[model samples]
Target: MYKSQRELKKDAVRAFLKDCKEGRFDGAYVFSGEEDYLKEHYFGLFKKYFLGPGDDQFALTVFDDMSFVLEDFLDELDNVSFAMSNRILLLKDVDTRKLKGEPRKQLLDALAAVPQGTAVVFYYDSAYLAGDDAARRARQSEITALGKSARLLEFSRQDARELVGWIRRHFEAEGKRIDDQTANYLILVTDADMVALNNEIEKLALYVEGPDVSREDIDEVASRSTGVNIFEITDCILSRNYDRTLRLLTACRLNREEPTVILYHIGVMFSELLYVALAAARGITSVDTVAADFGVKANRKFILRRYFNAVSTLNVDFLKQCIGLISEADRNLKKSRLNKWTELEMLIARMISAQIRK
Candidate 1:
């Protein structure tokens, strides 16, 4: 596990420079991250650093599917110029957010048994790659283990604050600045989609010649974005502030977000708290004990700790009732008897009242 975006960027730069300097057949490189620029940046390197003028590098290709086989790319790589020592093959979107299936497997195999004198890169949106599916999780570990020879660059997903910081860095990188008001506006508009936010910043920087970009600039240039923050929903429930709760709810419906998405978010969080509640009821005495016994996701521990504090005074009977609420909500969402959003709203409201963790 490579964990930092900067680390990945540095490794990529180092790999490209090394390939150019040593003339070694660097078999393959894996750029895994949520940042889209990694794709354009490295692919540009393949063009500028390696492919000289008048070089028709048929050996270069971009693959969105991870299942892309090394054999399938052999035709392109086989025609490699005797003059140029290595070829560039890009297997993009390997984790299958943009593409999937046989191509993903093929790409993995290419990384496993990469041909000499060729530079291949297998890319994935690491945010999606680390999602909770067991099989997907195993596939990532398998690929990392098998591609022992390939240099690995892993890009971790940016959270809300980090994404905003990235936006600030982008402006600074271009020798421009965003005004405080404009910065907040951009953050609000992009809603922490780093890729989209970066794109907007580029356009705004180009449109305005001054060092400072104003809030008005963001309104005029940045794309309208949606989707309630996962934290907002959780925080609202924890605080039990009616207006804030309804505000998030209204944001959800106003954005035309799918009820299933909201349910997925809230349900997952509640399911976690339910586990905490259940653990405490089971005579589990401490946070460390609950964490070690259940073996939950790392981030979930904070949420678990909150649950314990909230429901400390509640007895086992109330905890059982809360567990039943989550199950009922899940069942209702799965069925068609009532509107999904309404059912979720009601479930959340009820849970707040239940004082599972007041």
Candidate 2:
């Protein structure tokens, strides 16, 4: 059956798991995507499946394609497995866009003629194909040719619901419980990177020493990702919570977040708020429309609603003034000799004071 790229991506994990269960070993495979955790996890599974309980050093071959010679890779693939029925060859960081002319043709030809007992896997850690359109097209053509004789799997970011389920299972495996609300809170406070989330979960499980992990536990222990802290600062500003705003800003600085980065995020939040405010004035209250107009993801609709409500009482002139203040602070951070911290603190103070006066 023919499937679109989107469909293939959507079912990539499920298909791989099916192949794993059925013991289907294709001669060649391609693993590319943004989700490093999933890619690495599946790679481990493949290793176990192919190598079994034997010493992997004899059966497994890994190469960093950046420095790897194509001829050497082909030589290794042609060699029979010493300790297993099949040899597993892993090529990491295979940036196809960089491969051109004779080397490219030789690699593609070698992939097409992979030995019967050899399983070759190309792993790309990047989220997207790099280079100009021509280079990208050439890489896509190579991938398409490989797809005819292999499995091309792409791992994308999991949405909120998928993340929630993953969090639940992670806690359950440790004989601990995390309620949905608490799980959602954890997701909000952290960047939705599974690797980071897993680390936090491990830390929380070890610290709680209880059957249930609570929201308070997460608040006390989980490191707030930079993006989350930035959002919190903006939320505080929108709600007119000056004390909380300052505390969040302090937390950001303590975490070693750069002053300019903080200012940049503040600027973005105000700009978004200004757009929402203008949209509301035109009587556009539909979440879908607002999301489409402002590029907000579905999972973040609730946060957008908060922004919409907060901005309802704010006028355009005030929003403009806030943006102006942020811009000035940004320039000062880059050009002025003043202490960056002091300049940032003054910027936040001025924004808060302006909001209070409004």
Candidate 3:
């Protein structure tokens, strides 16, 4: 079996946790990746290790991209804590690559010059990393310089199996138990964001009367994400349930989802369906292979079943037609003055009509 990105990061996370437990000190560290929950969880561990049963509130200083001052940050690094613990400086979501010219050089040099007794952490939120192409390129370019002076660690999202296991463990800790199918259902409805998942888990644990959790309970209590709603919308279209499709789309609008955003996800769903159809025609039936080839996140491979099933009934030509309709709607959204919801409903109507004519 091929090693996944999460599997590759496991050793690093283990080592880091061990170092924190053992009080191993590094001058500077960089935390960046898609898994925000791990970053925060491990940071809590590190804080406990460093602070240790004392009121050492002054030992740690935090700064964000907007609030960071190079001189002030350097000053904090230079100062040793009187409380006998190492001083720690945290820089949150500050990508040094965007600094430009001399400021960028100064920041890199400062990272290298971090005193032995002080530790600096640069945390990159997934939101920042998920930015436009230009920002991503800058992030890539900064890694070389950042790597020279700091230990770089990435906390990637877990695979589906791992996440399901994690969900079970969380419920077990809360004195409740959830089966795999219900766990997966929760994942489907809530999307894969761990912080959000944690919140929902707490809600379910409190809301459930018995020890066991059910899918019906999840349907009753857990909040649905727009991504899941998009999936449902696609499923409705595929099933030729025009009324439910329009109702769901209207619900999305009421929830304040933009037409462009909804249209974008619809376009992506159709595109992926087209890719799966092409792969099927080429005699590739392995879900794992197709998902890996399509660059689907490991945690989201469970979604491949829906895509494959949808593609089984959909010809490439129809999928292409759906994509074309999406493109035209996108153009209309940009230039035409038709009510946004009406354009979207018309798009759905046309997609369903195409399927009927088939």
Q: lDDT tens digits, residues 3-91, model 2?
A: 84546787877878778777877788988766788888988888887667777787878888567877788778777533347788887
What's the lDDT of the predicted structure labeled candidate 3?
0.83
- Pairwise TM-score winner, candidates 2 and 3: 3
Q: Residue-pair clashes per candidate, as listed? A: 11, 0, 0
Residue-pair clashes, model 1: 11
What are the TM-scores, per candidate, against the unseen true structure?
0.62, 0.77, 0.92
Pick out the ten consecutive residues of candidate 2 with the lowest summed lDDT.
296-305
* Residue pairs in candidate 3 whose N, alpha carbon or C atoms collide under 3 angstroms: none
Residue 155, model 2: Cα distance from true site in angstroms: 1.8
Which runs in model 1 stand beyond 4 Å of their true positions?
Answer: 1-25, 52-59, 64-71, 81-86, 93-117, 126-132, 158-166, 173-192, 203-228, 238-247, 254-256, 267-328, 355-358
RMSD (Cα, Å) of model 1: 7.0
After superposition on all C-alphas, the RMSD of every candidate to the true structure, in Å, is 7.0, 4.7, 2.2
Cα lDDT tens digits, model 3, 111-228, are 7777666778888878877655697877856754686778878888776788899999999999999998888888888777788889999999999999999999998999898888
Please rank every candidate by lDDT, starting with the best.
3, 2, 1
Greater TM-score among 1 and 3 belongs to 3
